[model samples]
Target: MARFTTSTLSKYLLQAQVAAQALHTETAPVPPEVHVPLRKQLKDEAKKQKAAGKKKKKNANNQVVDGWELTVGIEIHAQLNTAKKLFSAATTSFNDDPNTRVAFFDLAIPGSQPIFQKETLIPALRAALALNCQVQTVSRFDRKHYFHWDQPSGYQITQYYEPFARDGSITLQARDGIAAEDGDGVMIGIKQVQVEQDTAKTLAQPGGVHWLDFNRVGAPLIEIITLPEIHHPATAAALVRKVQILLSAVDSCVSGMEAGGLRADVNVSVRRGDDPSAPLGQRTEIKNLSSFKAVEDAIIAERDRQIAVLETGGVIEGETRGWSIGSTETRRLRGKEGEVDYRYMPDPDLAPLVIGDDLVSHLRESMGQLPDVEVDVLIKEFELTPKDALSLTALDGGMRVEYFWNVADALAARLGLDRIENLACFQLAANWILHELGRLTSERSEAASEELGFTEDGQCERLPVEQLADILFYLHTRKITAKIAKELLWVVFRGTIPEKYPSVLGAIEEENLWFDELSETEYAELADEAVEGQEDVVRQFVDYKQYPQGKLMFLVGRMIRLGPEERIDPKNAERVMRAALPEKYVPALKASD
Candidate 1:
């Protein structure tokens, strides 16, 4: 082999350095990702599992390694998507310039005390109810002392000891857990859900000094703490993702990981599988896991690190660690803080929150339909399977769900809601929105198109909700075949005038796009046209009394292009075809012998 020249070697060195950096950023896989293009695959799989009312069997990588079991509990810091801060009137809008969204209370000026905003309780109660938590009739605020770049007050207001709610649970699928053997799947325990104020953001400076952006200071937060119910990284990631979706569904928070709408701190520990209920070993906290994929990776790396340490007769340390993307391992950041170090105490400035039954009832009544409840209603009223219903109402199925309701309303205007005839319309709408539209929109390749890139949000925005309903209406009425529906949809997707409904109708008529309204006589003409070159088949039919069913259908399919938008009656077309043949070819009934 030829050796590299000095110039080529220099180029090689740069590439090698870059390759090493890329390796450092990604850690060992928990299960070699279930599929590639990480985020979307996990999301799609989660939807499939949720709809099926089941969890996947634990992946082999998810199980214990070297007799060691992983115990994980994730703490979700969900920032409330409210108009103002938790306790201040300053706007929480992300549109403002840096450091502009701040108040006197945020600065921690002397004699400044927080006065509560009553509206914050709306989302708080909604989220608690959604989580199946027991909302406390009364909850108190407390002070947590800590020093950081953002907390100018030297302490944070929170619900430390007696949080706003407790004793809630969310279902998950763990490798080995109490619920797994019971045939109920794994149920992760919720220790508490507390309302608190967030500290300011920090920026790096030229020297050792830090820059504090107080805009985020005193922001409202709901900390959901789990009770060591999760046992695998994938399970933990799925559960946290579900929580984020639930928060968004209820309008409790934005749940955007990059913008810090939601953040998770996953605590990982290990114990021997021989005694599953044994006290867990010392734990390490993987702090601020921003994405679901990151959560899965961090847990696997940290667990492997712990297992390797213990396998060598070394003890696992209880400390805080950060997963470095450039290093692909959990780096020691700082020692973990025990609860006693925070010096939690009651806050005298704010009055204790008293949530009465009337308020709870009002809030519950005002709330929109939750995903689970919506799924049930669709199953019964719409004649959908549990899986179909669950998928339609899933938190990630935002566009589909919204389209379903609005499409129903549009169809109801055309076909009365209570009429039995409208059932066809309802089913058609759901099928298109849930299945066909997704396939069509996702295949669009134009970079500038609305449906160009498939997003992790899992909602397709190819066409306006109303326009889609219109397309479904045509399909429901048998005006178009499933294939032709895509043509009309593409037109709508590309059309500049979204509001001009007549223009959509004009395009269909002008292009002769849909064969839906074609009469029986017209279809026979198409069938006649299809059989034009088949003189041999015609001669055979004239001699033998039989025209092959498969041959006839193949001809019809070729002639009409069998689209979704067409109102095609096959029996009628076949009848016309039989009549078109001469009397000599007509089959004669045999006389009784």
Candidate 2:
């Protein structure tokens, strides 16, 4: 055996000391007798450190011993990319005709055996590679026994004693605004990632009736655990967002939160660095947080609850809790279980995964540039802000980023504009997609429930990406006012645009029928016609040199209400109204203009 060097021995001794010191202040039961030797080793390491004139770095945010500092970790369960279930040949598609995709093995019928799919292993390997983790050549699955109505099998197959990968890192950013960057941020570390299977979903209905959908049962999932390095609620949310983006970039993992493709389990604990020897407070595992806002709220609520418990001298018990997003609180669901609680036994049906060089090579080749590297490239090559780059790369849907890039390039070409390649433009696209499009879709969906057939929902649902891009480009070119764009978008949503418009001086042609029905000359004449009918408002405008701002819109509104029959062009209506109005009133008309 090789002799231990002074530095190596010193390092081990210091770690042992820290462990021993931590154990000493515990009010709970003492550790096993085996820890005594570990304590001695730690003392030896501390002495070695002293001799070497070294001091451990202090924590970033220093607080008094009595103050609270949270220790947060996340365990993300991402469904693997596979055509079928892990142990069965049943399809794993979501929202499919229920029970139709299940095989006998998935239903756990008598005498039905489990057989692992080889394609499933490839995604796990690819995920491990994407995470920069050390993949174990001989990882084995174990049985995680549990009893639930949806789980046909008595236990879930998971990796415990030896996981597929161990030790990794992911970096993210915290933005200053909902979609803006201008804030301080830090890097967090990943602990490990393991492959597992998802349980079926339980849907509860009114009248106390519950339904079980086994459509998702036995679907492969990867659980990624992070170190307790996060310091703030916002950072925790941002980290999850980053992970979603990274997973999406890796083609194997779907990154849709709405589709239930990804889920997160957050672990939170509080400790005082000044008293590192003292045991950290009880940890709470927040279960299955599906949204970033919910995760942040849960973290804040858990931290506050933990602080309250400590202030009252009440012992914080370790347990699993469910987050109530509406109430912004966590309710204890069950007691925390140790590894032994699951009775983890090696899975007998599936053989050990023997990772070969070719397998590793194939996975590596499949791995494209990860989000972080791509963000860096965007910043360097396109002169994008760190926040902007992160926003573009952090989109949950894989195609959103690509679509954004395509639109940005198209806009650049159409407008003869530079900096189209900049990530800031991509960030703009992300903001619009996440906020504007999302809000529009949601509002339209609600309206559809009570409204007629030709509603915004129908229009929005049919809105195409190319048309949206064209509208945006038109706005950017200043060819259309914001108001006109909005109207045109509604038109596009409800009607079709012609191939071309008639020349400004030419007789309106059939191709420009929509506009021809609302010709500029006709609109000017309508404004004149409206003046004849609304002489009182027109007299007020001429005498006071200003019409009531309300009346201006009302007049314009009348002309527009005339539709194509009255032949009113909105732009010409505004122009004719301004030209006919007195000088003082013209400014008000211009303001409307």
Candidate 3:
């Protein structure tokens, strides 16, 4: 029942050991009912002790809550995709050969020097600009002292006091039914965004010793903190996903939860608004939420835990907690650390980042259509639904939206139609990408026998986007049936272009053009051969035409199936079957015919 910090938990465990000696001698292991009541008493005592400790540290000037308002904020760390470290020339690649990428400056040896990499700084600026932040012309870095084996520097060089940007806002659309609407629209807000440096990774070992990998040290990192505008766990998850998309759109940040490029620190606090003077309860910070689902789960569990504490007239302590994904519970790590003087000052070794007028103009000019702009354009120009546009532009990989539109435009041209100009093509493209191409690629990636690099060009065993798009478009235009198109697409992806048409179309044309290449006599002979192959069905159809409509269609189906390499007109086969039927059977076959 007691809310304790990691340090406090250790103390309590030590105290409990001393107290247990006396209690064990005075009491005996008893019946279940007695033990239950005794445990409850001990829990109540613990809760009292926890509340008394928290009350001593309460700040009187902090905001008071009545009961209904819940405050939520997020700290997002997005890794920048720069070739070098922010403050050092060390390579900023992930999962590299351990400490090999570390430069002397990164290692922080005595008399070691530091040099700011413009490559990293520019991308960080671009990201801040994309986030709608006011870029600071002069920013400074400071040494944040922390003890960790991986941090050979004994401190992390990061921008804390004067960040590259501040007061930025990102607009995100909440899922329907998540947020309350004002008249007709829902509202979201952003707090701020700051730039920082990433820490080294700690690889776990069996005996609690971790192998330090400094490859990630000094990597440029941007932290985008949001206002507690989010009302639900689901909404928080959604906002994180939207931020990922926005970061990815700028091409400065590599945003992926699985790849450790994006991570979130979720802060959850609960309040009761019914009482006007009720205190705003303590908040718990859930650290390192790597995935969106983990963010949601941690928030939900923290919220519930805080609510229970308040209901029992207890207090929640402000502390950092770790989320256990396997158990879906939050364990207190440490109490909030007091703010330290970072001793922030401009680096004498590196020049201040000055944003000239011309550079700003060029950057603005080079900025392509951003995700939000693309979403709006897709809806207005292409007449797509908001949901559809969002999905098309929200992917984390490749030029999905552009590629989709390009292929859609190409198909429209082939059909002698104008560009989408309406929602029809947008809807069609969404369905094709999500249901067919996306599904196929995901499945194939999972099934690969070896390392199948998605970004590799002309990989012998990889699928091509062009080939997939062509097949889908062909099927969309009714140039091939669903079944035939699927088969042909598989063949094309496997690096084999069927010899029907010159390519996919040629293969499709081969099916229909088989009859064109043959003489009339030859075509007639082929039809006779098809009939002879299904003599049993033919005799039954000749005897009882009405009873074998399905059988007749099956027989015609087989004729096409058998001569897949040879073109046969499905319409002509039906005509020939009707003509070959006996006179007595013809009258009864009218309905099926």
Candidate 4:
């Protein structure tokens, strides 16, 4: 029946911890920086008596079926990909040796003072604007007092009392199979976005030793907190991914969870009772979830765990839990602390941050086309389906936007902007990019990352927009079939263009010619060869009229693949093949149409 929210439950524990501090010789008034280990150890030992190793309740796996209202909120810490740290001149480079990238101010050395970096505000402003947040005219820095192994300065410089932006919203695009949970047009409210400095990296050794690396000490970070409106795990994951893409587009963060630069903290609570307006249950905080998928899984695991506790007549304890990848369960990390425990105060070293109309307007005009704008253009103007448009932008973020832009540019060049404004040309370009280029390019990216040592973001190094444009233009103008377009995109990505595809000049006759430059005569020859030897199909087509249009397409498509990689325009080939199917068999094409 004991609950953490009631101070009476933890009174003696706090008293004992305070009394025990005097026995240690680690210096009384211990800077709060050196006493983190003892506090962590105390929190650990206390959880052992509270059923630490108990498995999740198998009987109450269905939270919804068992009548529970689950509420979830997400907190994302995005490490801005900036040139320098937020409050120091230290370079924000990852993978550097431990303690090497630290600036003098990062260590709080003598005569050191925090110098605010104005350039670091660009990405933060861009991200805030993209999310529809109201940028504050003035914000301030607050020192968050804490004692952790990773934080050597005994506190973190953050936006505690006031943040850069607030009261924003993100409109979830229609269910496009990517994240079906956050359905169409659902607008998730943004609480606030705060710019802060990251802590150092803590490396755990084998024998209970922890080494602190100061390389990440002063790195700039932005925390995007959402209002507690999420009810499903899939929706939570969707919001996380959308924010990640938005950050990547604005150069706010690399958004890579594996690199430890981007992480998420999920807060979940479940309500079950006869009353609909009962006070919200005590929320458990899940710490440091990295992947988007992991966010979904951890939310579901913790939600069920909360329900399991409630159904068993057990009070839900307000605490922090860590998601375990190996066990697929949430393990207790430590007792949760209220806002008062952090002792937030105005930081003396730094002054209040102020932005004017000119600064806000500069960042506003500097932002490129956002996802919503791109989707509207792709759908309303280009006449693409909502699914295809969302797929192009959401799946790969900035790179996909760039790729589609190149496709549009190539189309405009080939057909002129006025002519390419029609639905057919735009739809062709969209479909080819989403279905064909999307699949093959992903494979190429993986290969490049493994073989060429390219960064995850740099996997598109070989994908020159001009070269990709060449392939897309062919499909847009009906100059080549989708099959030929795919082949051209793959070959062009791998090597030089305007040359024979095969390595041996004469070993396999001549190499395949590029689709864009193929002659019309070549298309006719390929079509003639397709229906040349099929007599039975020809009889059925002319005399009996047995097969349907679907059957005809299947046979013709298969026949097209038998020949060399010539510039055989599929539309031209289909027309010519039907034209040569004798005058009587023409009704199969016309009537079907």
Candidate 5:
């Protein structure tokens, strides 16, 4: 049998088309009888599938049943956030018209040579250092030859033999969406990280015609390979998310799975038994999973598929497959390609990439703080709850984290205290930013996009940091009650720029929303006035003793209504009301108090 690779398949299709066209010129027309049976067979199969869809179907058990063990390793190709193509000076763009961003070198025009872009190395180095990988002093590129419409050059330039970095690791914390069975945390090893060129996108139209978009060709990419250390499907998903977070934190890659900034290729295999020495089953590679959920579901579906094949005394083919979200199954794409099929060779155009230790040190110093480190600082130094820390850091690619820090620091400055000395301010800032403003922003972001505006990354600009700090400052200083402060927050959230009024304090003063700074004597007078009118409520409290606390609260509400303009603090009103209560109605106080 002829071995059919991608290159061979394209040639075969072309040759067969030529032969068919020539034969059609010389041969007589076929009879209708030749086509009727095939049409009938397809229609019958469609009817059967349609009928089966109407019945309630049990979800296939994806659990690795009894004695099976599964392992998964992920390969991620993340497009670096750079302005130009890896080898050409053609600008990179996601929304540009197709074929417009291509350079002569990108299109493999005659005599066009590859020129390495030194700017690409800074981000690549930051990523390697963030992942704890050892940077190699020298790395070289290789040409992996294959034929597909996506590759105009007919080969991909990659770092296969000497990747720039290796032996990194990332820990999957239990709190970071890993399953409990995976233990507190699992440290997964990074096999290597390499720089590569991306191929053009292939969009398949009807009738087997594939359109090539070269806007993506020769764009810089970093391929992160991991050892097959994952045992469960959820863990694999968590690992991918960890990589996304780390890459985004360092400003190396946006890692936006939906926008094609990041794509994962998962290799999954299963075997029977718990022995470490057991021979592994033939593994199938699932290509181009675009979402975290797809990463998990594809692994489970592939694992179950392999187990089924093995249990039926059948062989699992080592092939490439595509994931079907609709059926939740893996569909075969092609048999796997091995090293010989790729025909890897050193690129004749580019020389070895050499880096000095000083450059690596500079990148390491210039790297932004990672998310985990920021999470720890939020929890320890800032005294935020662990839950709030994670939520704050995870929002909008850590833009919220920056907003929170600014608010917290400004509050401390206004209060004339160190942040550590005023834990209440940090806690208050976290509560409002994470819960109140966080929710308000999320709910109104779409409707108020123009009013709220957005950062360069498209995150809704959080309520300005100074305005939030002013509100917190007033509440801290007892100038405004929490209730009035919340009202102030809502006012500022709905496009009310408190800074225009000079500050939140200025807004409060200008709007007459400040809490009444009344004395205890004034509160007692109001409480007395409250009891004089509501005789029935007072009777229930003093004589009938029916729901005494509720009746007393009713009196407090009455007193508050009388002074609505005062913005009366509810706690002070309730306290003064209890004190002004008729002695007969006074509940016995605890001796301990």
Candidate 6:
């Protein structure tokens, strides 16, 4: 240390005194001469800044967690149901013996060359149109280099630099239970859709030996990539389901997650701020998620984990993870691969794919109504509840939708009605088809389903649509009770209609399967007989504060059962019971009603 001169020491002391005075001035009360408006303005500005800093954010679960935001994106690889493999003449079969379907090109033989299949492009174009993607007239393939037993060629052919389609989006509607708070649908953008080849299946043996199945090698795939704009796990899952519906509607792919026809790779990240323009957080991808529930649960689990790590002052590592179904968590697989690691290069064997404008137009004209469009039509034209419409359309690739339409058309034509006097009947038909028919069909095995004259996808060929419509029409006209209608439905479903009757109405008339309009005196006698043995239940219903209100229906049904030979009107029995009771108990009876 060097000694300081007296002048230098005085200079340092003066600087310290000035800093202390400024600090005191900031902390202490202001003088009376300070303008009140200026002081108020400064306080207001400070409050605004604090409020902006601590703004609330929502997690992937749509729960409020201040200062935390979630981001999610998905990549889907769907196997095309084409006749042949992408670059070979081998037939595509899911159930073929392990390596029997492999072509020489699939094995990377010494002199074999890849011959691109023209059949695969039709489905790819269909998918592009279904997703609202812009198809590229000229697109080429590139080789993605990697070292794995799954790819014997040491590289897989894909579209890296130039993809088949781009700039598409799938809308998740609010009625479909996505973004319900917004009251409108949210649109998830598609980055690109590429045609690529899939890797082989790897089977691990007991002693760590691996078995390779080349049946899936060089199979055609259309990889769809979406932008990192989804903020909720539910939204991400909805996007996946919507893609499945659209692909199936266009007849492009089977879109079966359980059958391994479609695979999803979910990329999830979490950031501290809500500003979308801010740099995205480091993402970890959960690869090869095989189910919709796994897609949702994995995103939620990974997002929470990243948030937890960041809260503890730990940095997130970029890696690939696999979802553990048993533990309900994500386990690390390996470090994430970047573009440089893939070593992508253009494939010199195949020329650029050229699509004509005429083909696109022809395909567009040939396409039928898509699933999303049909969903809206069901809600608007037929007045179906959103839940019921979704349930009907989502089953077996819209097979239920077709069945429902057949019944609806039969009813409308027979009744000579449009939306008039048939809205409730339409809804009743929907309930019968979706609930009763669905449950009945779901209990059958594949063999049993076929025995009932149903296709593999549950399309009915033997069920009489007109007879089912007659049952609903009779119920709507109050000619038959709901119980009788259900019984007739069972008879119709099993093809057990009586031999003498030519039609459903004829059977109902011949068998007298209808209710008798009971007189008031007869209803009174039935109510009195019903109450003779069930006095305790009647008293409890009267004192409903102590007993459940469902006892009233039990008493009513008991009265109806007293006249079991003929179907007596239940409402008449209920009315007689209420009138026979004390007038003071009438209000309690109304409460039960």
Best-matching candidate per lDDT: 5
For each candidate in turn, the TM-score is 0.69, 0.65, 0.70, 0.72, 0.76, 0.80
- Per-residue lDDT tens digits for candidate 5, residues 1-593, read 23335464345434433433442443322222222232344356556667777432233344345788998899998988888889989888676665567666776755678999988887888889989999999999999999866677799999999999999999888767776668889999999999999987665444554445667889999999999988888889889888887887788884467556889999989998768698877788999997787788788888888998999999888899998433447899988554247888999899999999999998888876888889889889977776788788766667777777788778888988999998877888889877776455453454333334334342445466777788888887778888788878777776575446776767777878766666887877777777774555655654453558987788888888877545677888888887666552333222212
Rank the models by lDDT, top first.
Answer: 5, 6, 1, 4, 2, 3
lDDT of 4 by residue, 1-593 (tens): 22333243235323323433433434323221332332344346446534567443332233243477778888899998789999988898666655557666675544668899998998898889989999999999999999875665788999978998999988776542224434464778999999998987665444454455667888999999999887777778778877877777677785566556689999999897466699888998999987776787788788877888878999888899998542346999888565338889999878889988798898788877787687787777777777777777765545665666665666677667663456687576667656665555344464433321122332345555555655666555555556666666666556655355433112122544334533567655665566565554655665444545664665468546865545455565566666656563455455654
Query: 337-427, model 6: which lDDT tens digit per residue?
Result: 5523788999999999898989989998898788877888888877888888888787766777887888888889877898546688898
lDDT of 3 at 239: 72
Q: After superposition, how far is residue 519 of candidate 2 from its true place, in Å?
A: 21
Any runs in candidate 6 off by more than 4 Å, and if so which? 1-64, 179-183, 274-277, 337-340, 443-459, 479-484, 487-523, 533-548, 560-593
Stretches off by above 4 angstroms in model 4 are 1-66, 176-183, 256-259, 337-340, 394-399, 417-420, 431-447, 450-466, 475-484, 498-593
Q: Residue 565 deviation, candidate 5, in Å?
A: 11
Model 2 scores a TM of 0.65
Q: Candidate 6, residue 147: CA error in Å?
A: 2.5
The collision pairs in model 2 are 13-45, 14-45, 16-42, 17-42
Could you tell me the lDDT of residue 19 within candidate 2?
A: 38
Q: Model 6 — TM-score against the truth?
A: 0.80
Put down candidate 3 lDDT per residue, 488-548, tens digits, no spaces.
7566655567433457666666555222333445445555566664545655765553677
Q: What is the alpha-carbon RMSD of candidate 6 to the true structure?
A: 21.7
lDDT for model 6, on a 0 to 1 scale? Answer: 0.76
Off by over 4 Å in 5: 1-65, 204-210, 324-327, 337-340, 440-462, 476-478, 481-495, 498-500, 517-593
| Candidate closer to the true structure by TM-score (higher is better), 1 or 2 | 1
Candidate 2 lDDT (Cα, 0 to 1): 0.64
The lDDT of model 3 is 0.63
In order of TM-score, best first, we have: 6, 5, 4, 3, 1, 2
Write candidate 1's Cα lDDT for 292-384 as tens digits: 767877888788889889888998877989974322368898875553388889998888899898887787788777765676678677887
Please estimate how well model 1 matches the true structure, expressed as its whole-model Cα lDDT.
0.69
